[model samples]
Target: MNATPTEMMTIAAARLLTNQDVCFVGIGAPSAACNLARLTHAPKITLIYESGTLSTRPSVLPLSIGDGELCDTALTTVAVPEMFRYWLQGGRITIGFLGGAQIDRFANLNTTVVGPYDAPKVRLPGGGGAPEIASNCGEIFITMAMGTRAFVDRLPFITSFGHGKGKGDRAALGLKTKGPTKVMTDLCVLEPDPQTAELTVVSLHPGVTREQVQAACGWPLRFAADVAETPPATEQELAVLRDLHARTRQAHGVAA
Candidate 1:
């Protein structure tokens, strides 16, 4: 059988991160992608966590930023405040790995509330350190499963942050960081427009169609006029990615 969508997403994210200068990673998809990069390429990258761990080398994806495994494998865990202030806020982190409860075309994220701010739909896990990471990290790499529910036209609340307000806002704000550098989804890879930072599908998987991608997104999605086909995962890439997931599931006690 071919790789699953989740596996494809991880591989796309991993390839993008393989050459990042530095990464401020969150848990889950980002963790898997970051570790994949470490195991393959970009060994010199400095991986920092919001929990104050730096240069961690975990054999599996972390359950959360504060998981003890992070501390154990870290080069050295430092004071939390110092981590945010001295490193993150100081703009030392070159890339940030982000996931979201909801996202928009601009790659803005919301993890605070699902429906009305006052009351309504589900209330997701509060943005623990996401707000800080979203704004502080030099650049961001968003990883999320593609579905109408998750990639909304607009988020109910602004939980974290966006690339300024819209288009040229990030540049106008004099932000040196690249904002969101890339977005990896199950069916395609998206990139922000050079001028507007609006997300456009740059590449699509072999069997995925533009109509299907748009159908799956919550909002009216945009596609590049000339989108390219994504390169299929090489045997080596697939093997490494599969091995990583197997190891992660085993560690987390996922039922065999």
Candidate 2:
């Protein structure tokens, strides 16, 4: 099957996770990305779920952290406290993959509310363990589709701190994670500027224009001095991704 832009984004995101990475995987796109990595180049990558499943190698993508597939395939399961204390906060995990309702230039995420916290226009699923994941992991990789609504100028509420205000804010707050290091979107790949720690476009997907990306973002987006075009997903990657999703649908009884 040919890859869609979203699939391309997932493949690109998966490629970033190396065999050496111990990734703290989220449920949605993050789960798919990590699983793809495990199926492909990053076969040795350790996957730790929020529900305490460690080194999980599920046959299909899990619906949530509590899904039986995760625990069934995991090397071992620990209590939530031990998962957080000994694995996450203990500085064992290398990458934290996240998604957000709204993201700012500094990559601070808001999964709590859409509008004012007091009287929100939309109340979103509150961050579950994301704050800890953001703070404790060695680095964070955010995957989201780019849109003006999602790429907001000011987040109404910050559910997980990224670079915060940029610069040394994370360090000032005593956060051990390096904060958001990369953002993979349907249109492009963004990374923080080395000097300012502000999110900047580092690569664009095939056929995506700079103007399109700029228009999607709420704030004025920045571009690296030498932006590169993201390579399209190879046939092998597309096959793996398709198979993964197919099995996920089959396992859940979703129509193909």
Candidate 3:
């Protein structure tokens, strides 16, 4: 069966993880991506949710971090304070997977407000643990659908600092984490330019065009000299992903 772009994006994001990775995972795209990686190539990948679930192996996609499936399938659960202080702040997690309402070229995320902080044009779901996840995890992996509206030249608020004002800022501020390392979207994969710390397109998904990716980005996006085409999802991956989504929908009484 052919996969949709969203599925392709999720699979592409999952490919970044390895069996050795311990990821601090968020819900929605990030959750699906990490779970797919575990169910497929990276079976030993450790998935930790913000709610203190450690090495959760949920059978279906969780609706939220607090979903009972996370606790039910987790290797162990810890207190929220311990989850933050020991796992996250202690730099035990390898990847912090997140999503947001808006992201800037520097990879800083804005989940607080759309227009203005005082009286916003659109108020988003305020940042929960993203600030800590972004600051303390070894690095971050952002998963969001690309669009001009979601990718902005200037974020109204920096809910989760990426590289800060680019290059050395995060380090100057004494953040423990390395900030966002990769951004996975429907069109392509973006990584920080080694020198500038600005997010640059490094790979395009199958059947995606460079123009399409550029059009979606709010800034003048940069591309690596030898950008590669992301490998297509294998049959096994599609099967597992579809089954997960199917189970999620069924559990919620939604049509598949």
Candidate 4:
């Protein structure tokens, strides 16, 4: 009857995609949310991967971007270079779904080195194609677990670009694609400021307080004066999401 935090986040993210959009889906939360969209409202939405697979429909969560299921179930598989050159860089792909190690107020992400680029605190798996995804995709949506460490006022490094020079700067940079359109976190949904595009809490999930959301965020996070409450996920949404995760773990040999 109630929505798990993940399911609520997925529903919130799913609503952003549409049948007319071509989406570049990241692994984990982004994958789950994108698939939810395909199964629910945006059945015709085309899903793309960095590995050059398009329109992928896996019954289970993929272990990684390199998983064979993506290519196997894809509508077509292009060469890695071709995929970016034509589909992404060519300005055909409409949406990019991504997750990162660190996010800042400007919504820029850090996926390269953890603390410093050279002498890092914790070196993470470098951005696979996230930079290009952010740069070339028509638009993007980011999904990540919200914790004080992951959400900060300034990223440890700028691994993947969002609103690098702040909002409105993207237009001045002569970029074709817009910056991150939204971010879906466990306790809330955030959108960039209209001018600066700095991220601020726009809505709080049901039963979540502004203080709780702020405590979880790393930075001195700001909240809208009139933030709205997030609607809990419906029965149908929970069933689908739970089943999907169950099958994902069972098929991948990953314990849930």
Instruction: Please report the candidate that would top TM-score against the real structure.
Output: 2
Superposition error at 218 for model 2 (Å): 0.4
User: Can you give the lDDT of residue 246 in candidate 4?
Assistant: 91
The lDDT-based order of candidates, best leading, equals 2, 3, 4, 1
Per-residue CA lDDT of model 4 for 84-194, tens digit only, reads 898888988888999988898888999888776789889899988998999998888999878988897777788888988686777887886887979999889999877
Q: What is the per-residue lDDT of model 3 for residues 15-64, given as tens digits with 9 covering 90 to 100?
A: 99999999999989999999999988899999999899999999988887
**Candidate 2 on 1-256: residue-level lDDT in tens?**
5679889889999999998899999988899999999999988899999899999999999998889989999999999999999999899999999988789999999999987888989999998899999998999999998999999998999999999888899889877568899999999999999999999999999989999999999999999999999988899999999999999999899997
| TM-score computed on alpha carbons, candidate 4 | 0.95
Clashes of each: 0, 0, 0, 1
Q: In model 3, which regions exceed 4 Å deviation? A: none
How high is the CA lDDT of each candidate model? 0.83, 0.92, 0.92, 0.85
Per-residue alpha-carbon lDDT of candidate 1 for residues 130-243, written as tens digits (9 for 90 to 100): 887877887789999999888988788887777745777766766656778788998999998777778899999768899989988987777888999888877777887778
> In model 2, how large is the Cα lDDT of residue 197?
97
Q: Relative to the unseen true structure, what is the C-alpha lDDT of residue 128 in candidate 3, on a scale of 0 to 100?
A: 95
lDDT of 3: 0.92
Taking all chains together, the TM-score of candidate 3 against the true structure is 0.97
- CA RMSD of all predictions: 1.7, 1.0, 1.1, 1.4
